[model samples]
Target chain A: MQIYLPIAELPISIFLVLGIGAAVGFISGMFGVGGGFLMTPLLIFIGIPPAVAVATETAQIAASSMTGAIAYWRRRALDFKLGGVLLAGGVVGTVLGVAFFNAMRRLGQLDLVITLSYITLLGSVGGLMLTESLKAMLSARKGISAPLGRAGHPWYFGLPLRMRFNRSKLYVSVLPLLFLAILIGFAGAVLGIGGGFLMVPALIYLFRVPTAVVVGTSLFQILFTMLAAIMLHAATNQSVDIILAMLLVFGGVFGAQFGARAGQNIRGDHFRLLLALIVLAVGVRFASEIVLRPDELFSLGLIEIRR
Target chain B: MRRAALALLACWWAAAARAETMVLSLSSHRVQITSTYTGAELVIFGVIDNERRSVTRQEPYDVVVTAAGPRASTVVRQKVRLGPIWMNLAQRKFADVPTTLAQISSRPIVQIASPDLRRRFGLGLDSILDPAGYDLIYDPTFRTALIRLQREAGLYRSEERGVTFITPSIFRAVVPVPATAPLGGYDVDVALFSGGVLLAREDTNFEVTKVGFEQAVAQAARQHPIWYGAATALMSVAFGWLATVIFRRD
Candidate 1:
């Protein structure tokens, strides 16, 4: 069956959208990733406008991050003190990011910027993950623990505004944490991602936070940042398609449940390897799209739709 | 609604009487786009007065029907090789371009009329762009690219031999409304030709509008966008919470 999306002003097959949402949600649940990077490109490939795809996918990220945040809250894994400091910087980053996004859109450079950002970020993240997981797999076969996460102290530890985080059991500099949050928040707003993939590693290695607490803290900050992003996109660009978001959420919610269960059976190193491969494949696809010549050079843009 | 329909019919009749050659009528004058609206199909039927000419079975009549949606300004962009990647380099703004254009004719448009005549009548995709005062620095290939892209999107289309003659003077054409069709007034033009010359032309238009739930949703997103955004965020959060509650593993 086909359903008409109101804001996008198009009709898409119901099953096709649902299936896309479910598959993205499954990966998100299994890997604890928001999957916005995956979903946005797929939606654009299927003919949704690039602007609408970017704006609407943020709402789905907000939804999935909310679930993860609440679960972490129940377990008392979230450090509200640290999250608060990060959110303060995140709001600033979101404001600047939205302004930059509007400027790029006006110049008609948003698509190129988004595609290039995705290629670079995904390429690096995937490459790092592949090597790390392979090393872990090798170490496991030899029955020896991998000497990872020991890069000594981060350089920013000596920065100003040092504060103690009770839950994380660390006395980290607030300035660096706030700066990292701002950078990730800017990326989240502009790239339409949850920034978890970027934040998790930063929290673990740079801040020396425990792995147990990093995921929850990242989710908490992402929830707030995405909330700001959705509202800003709606107010400024008017690109949020609620009907599209709802359809995606319906499938995503259910798929996440099944994916979480499926994730328990797979070994951690193997799961990371699979996710890295998928990410790398998506990055390669995006890179090739830019490198290859387009089938058609000129494309139409609808300036207005008269009612 | 009935009164409006009657008024439109009266107006069409008045226009037809002035031409005194052909009369055109659509199956419906209004298309309601409800929540479940995927697409629509309308049938256009018309009659041509062949008594004026001697009917020797020598090409009785040729009918061409065009359904053109409301005109709007749009931009066409071209991608160029920028270093190692492709990027949008050149763009042109066109005024008064139809949002949706579907042409159905008894035979191929090229066979029916000359290119000059077709351009004058605004019959085909080639004539859609108005280069009146705009600079012509861009290559004509840009226009071809625009048409190709529109055709792929199912917006601009020309179906040769789409019109069928039920009788000698009576003909009907099926006009398909694609799912991506914009909401607005769509003008349907029916031209009767004899001996490769235009006999009479009838212009009738229909309104495609969003109604019910679809209207409400689209309106909210446009008008009360802030509240709509808040509501969307809140609902998403609630949905996420509900999912976690229902599917707790441990």
Candidate 2:
């Protein structure tokens, strides 16, 4: 049933929203990741405003992550020191990201930038995951460990501003981390993503941070970054609807809890493969928009702006 | 006990014997009608006083204006409630509710459109009957016509609970005259009803007049391409972002 709520006056189909929440929650519980990569678009498809969707999604992520973080802390799985470092960088990155976001808005090209970035990043990550997972699955059927690539050493290593990351057991400089943080920050600000996908891989492959510490630290950084984003958007635009956020967050917390438990039981390779497929499907759908023409694109003026 | 009863009876008799009358006048008694979009406005003014004693309580009133013509009819209603004399008796727990005086004095002007006029302007069929839908088409022309009708309708007065009353109120109601509405001389009647009973009536004449600003803007917006383009572009960007976020993977 559709209901008019006083808070936002949004005509919400409560049943539909809850059902979507349950399904997404289940997936998120099974996977050790935020389901925003899926939920935001689904909301839009159902006619929620885009700005409302993104702002609400961030609020949902905050709640979900808080629940997971608490559970992990209770179980002694959290690495406080590692989480702290990431958070420090994340805060700085968020500040810079918000600045960039405002500048883009003034240019009236913020939307274009956000769209292009999502397409490129989602497309690449999805493709990579799919390929790697497929290969792993094929190799496992033959009773063989897939060949792993060694970390290649560059001949000239004269990069400046090196810093030691004790938890990762690496002596890499601070420069790369700063650069990576800045890029992630921009993505976070523009897309309202936590940038965990990018951070996780970078932490594992580049810094060689232990896999156990990776998820925990990344979640920590995301928590800080997302909070900053929520605050910035709220204070500047008054665009964050508390009602919408509350609904998504209510669903997300339980989803994350279930996902964490499921992650423990599932085989890592198989889980990764499923995630890869889901990502690839989303990527293709997004790319199709650019390739396909829409029906009845309307305009009121002489110079037509095609969307 | 006998003395107390006698005093109470005497007070009741005195209050009943002293009834007050108030006079209300409008600046313009007749207004020219125009396109569905325009009309003459009447300014209403009046006074109230108790014949026996100064009224300690403020009076409440309602104004209604209606128009009738061939093919369409419309009504505009405004209400005012004066503050009670006993307002200082308590801390005013119901501050949110408007006072009787406030309701009668000033109100958002109401617009009424004849069904034929609405159709002529392409206002669609549903808007004519639905209050919400009608509000969506509240153009300047309709508003002006409403104001004019209210001005011409003159003063209305009513009493509720005998002690509280309305004086010198104004109302306008619109009705469609038949296709044979007289070109130069149209007889307009104004009637006052209290407790649903006719208290007074007046007759006047009017001539219909031309279109206004709001109608023109709405027409231009509909015909212009640039406006549509801008609106679409904004919607796409908003929707596009939503699509990307929802489909993104961890």
Candidate 3:
């Protein structure tokens, strides 16, 4: 079946979009991560205009994260204080990101920036995760346990505005946490991601937050940040396709149920390894598109005619 | 059962002795874009009505039908390789170009009319896209790209054999509107030509609109943006929450 998207002003196969949503949802459920990083790229590949894809994906991320955040809140795993601080920083970052997005779109360079950022962000993150997982896997085969991460105060801890996060059991400066949250919010708005994949790792390794609360804290923050992105993108750009987002969320929510059940049989290290490979493959594919010579050097776009 | 398709116009030639009237009708005047909309084809039927008292001519008559969708400004960008990556470096803007244009003629437009006459009637795609209105210094490549791209996208087309004549004075043509065709009013012009001279022309218009839920949603987004955003957010939350409840019952 074919469906017309109002904001994108195009027709697309209904099954194709639903399938992408399901597949990405399955992977996100299995890995316990928000699938926006995967979804935005796939939507773009399937011929959705980048602006529409990004803004619409933000709305999906908000919906998807709501489920995870609700579960975490009920389980008492979320850190409200930390999540609140991150949200405070997220507001500032989202505003700046929305401004940057509008300007880049006007200059006709939004596609280039989006493509390059995916290459850089996904490439580095995927690479690091791959090596770390492989090392962890190898040592486990030898029956040698990996050492726990040692929490240490880096130079940033000495910065002003030092604050305490009782739940994470850390007393550190709020500067680093705020700065990281801002980056996450900015990426969520500009790149159409929940930033949980990036935020979880940063919280675990950089800030040395407790593993028990890291995922919950990030999910809580992502839910609100993406919600903020959806509203701002709608108001400023008028590019969000609610129908498209609803279809994706429907497929994803259904698929994730099966995926979570299936994931229980797999080992933790194997799960990480699989996710790393998928992430790296997406990055490689994007890199090749930029490097390879394309068949059509000419492209078409519409410019608003202001009176 | 359908309504009668007859829409008559008496377009008179200068000389009353040999004057001819053009009568035309369209298959449909309104196209609705429902969820199942794929594409549509409008078959235009027309005829040349001449008073039987006039002397019959040896030369046969030809009919040319052209349809243009609503106009909008367009930007065609060319990518140049910069530091190992291809990016849009140069762009040319064409203001108020037809979103879609389809031309159907009984014979090749070139064979039907002289170059001067063709240009005057705006018969070909090139003539329709007059480049004289460029805001910047003109370049032919951009115009070439515009036509090439639009043709490939099925937005612009011309078919010499698309129009067929059942009789010398009676004719019909088909205009293909792709699924991606924009929604708006469409103007169709039917011109009569004989021996490289313009005889008579008639014009008619149709509309493409969205009905049902599609229309409501589009209206909400444009008219009540803030409320639309809030409603979308709430609906998305409901979809998400509903999914969990249905699937994760444990």
Candidate 4:
């Protein structure tokens, strides 16, 4: 179906859109990550204007994450205090990111930025996850137990703004958390993703948040970041496409529900590795787009319409 | 066990009995069109069958087209509403969007479907058609018909459809393009409705190109390479440093 908006419009199928949402949601639920990284690019591939796609994806992420957050909160898994600190940092980072987003839009460099960012971040993260998981798996086959502990580093211990997270049993400095939030927030805006994929890993590896708290905290932060993004897009670009958001949300909710249940049957490490591989595949596709010359290089300003 | 088996059979029979018998069929399994006309003519060709019982009088059905964006923020919207016309006499009724069929056909066809059936088998219709036991037809001559419609709607062609349709059911309409068209993407919505209710909606995108912008920028950037590179690098560093400062943990 085609929906008209004041700024732009694109034709889309309700079923296909729902299917995308379900797919993204399932992956997100299974991997304890947000599916924004997947959703944004898919939307662009389907011919959505990049700006509208990103904005709408944010809205959909907010709605889907709200559902997940509520469930987590009900189970007493949410760490509101830590989530608040992250959100505080996230909000500021979002504003900055939005500024950069608008500047790129004016220069018509937004697409290039998004493409480059996707390639770099996805490639690195995917490579890390794949290597680590493979190593762990091989060691496990030798009857070795994967070491689990915190790194005793002066950098982490000396950072200012120390806070205690009772649930995770950690007393860490807030600076690292804040910095992580900002990075994730910038990524969230630039890529039109919920940033949970990045945030969960950072929390686990950098801040030492327990795996249980990581997902819940990331969801909480994602909810706020997306809400802020919606408002920013609405105010500046007027790019939020409500129709697209609703379709994706409908699909994402059901997908998350099914995915969460299915996730219980799988090993977390294996799921993480699978997700990382998928991201790597997508990154390779993006990198090829940049490196490969097209049969016909049609350019209109910052937009390249390929035949 | 026998009683339980009998109960299950009864439930299955009850569900099967509740299915609708009347069927609707389109001449084409799919429809595709592209045009640049502001107001264009559109023609949709389809066939309907009353499978259970043939009525002496023609029944009314609504022909609707809807469009939505291919992204999450985009919405499912109705582009045109036509309906309740006598089915037999209006076997091939035309629905116009006031703009022109040529303009509407100028964009990609995302989906095409009918919604009256229980399963909603058609491509575009969501709430309007049943999915099972219906045949959608595609006519070869429809492309020529679309061209003729675009000529009637009054616009020059800029592009053509990248994909082909395999269905006999087709939809043709005229859409108007604003003079102040921006160089960006737009969603074209189409759908079919009956009795003030929506059947299905399809969305596709049409992009406006801003020719030469990339070349112009490249030329300018080359003229001031060092300055451009420095400015870009500085901005990136500043943004990165600012982010670090603001989001610092403590």
Top candidate (lDDT): 1
Give the residue spans of candidate 3 off by over 4 A.
A148-151, A305-307, B1-18, B52-55, B132-139
User: How many clashes would you count in candidate 4?
Assistant: 105
How do all models score by TM-score?
0.92, 0.53, 0.91, 0.57
In candidate 3, what are the lDDT values of residues B1-250, reduced to their tens digit?
1112211111233343346778999999998877777778988999788876375655778788999988888999988888998888998888878888999998899998876457656888887887432335556788889989999988899998898898877898888887777888999999887776667789998888888877777787877888878877887778777766765555
The local lDDT score (0 to 100) that residue B118 gets in candidate 3 is: 71
Task: State the lDDT at A91 in candidate 3.
Answer: 76
- Candidate 3 lDDT score relative to the true structure: 0.83
Best by DockQ: 1
Q: Model 2's DockQ? A: 0.02
Candidate 4 chain A, poorest ten consecutive residues by summed lDDT: A298-307
Off by more than 4 A, model 2? A1-9, A75-77, A99-111, A152-158, A299-307, B1-250
**What level of docking quality does candidate 1 show?**
medium
Query: Poorest 10 consecutive residues of model 2 chain A by lDDT?
Result: A298-307
Per-residue lDDT for A51-164 in model 4, tens only? 878877887777667766766776788899999989988988887888888888876557778988998899999898888788778778899977754558447646877888
The i-RMS of candidate 2 is 24.2
* DockQ of model 1, rounded to 2 decimals: 0.58
lDDT of 2 by residue, B30-102 (tens): 3332222222333343343344554332433322222222122222221112231111111111111100000
What tens-digit string does per-residue lDDT give for candidate 2 at A1-307?
5533222324466667766765676676677566767777677667565555665566666555555455455455666665665666777777777677667655444544555566788888877777887888888999999755466633222367655556556565566666677677667766667777678777775666777777766766676667766666554433454545645655555555556566788777888888878877876776654444423121111111111
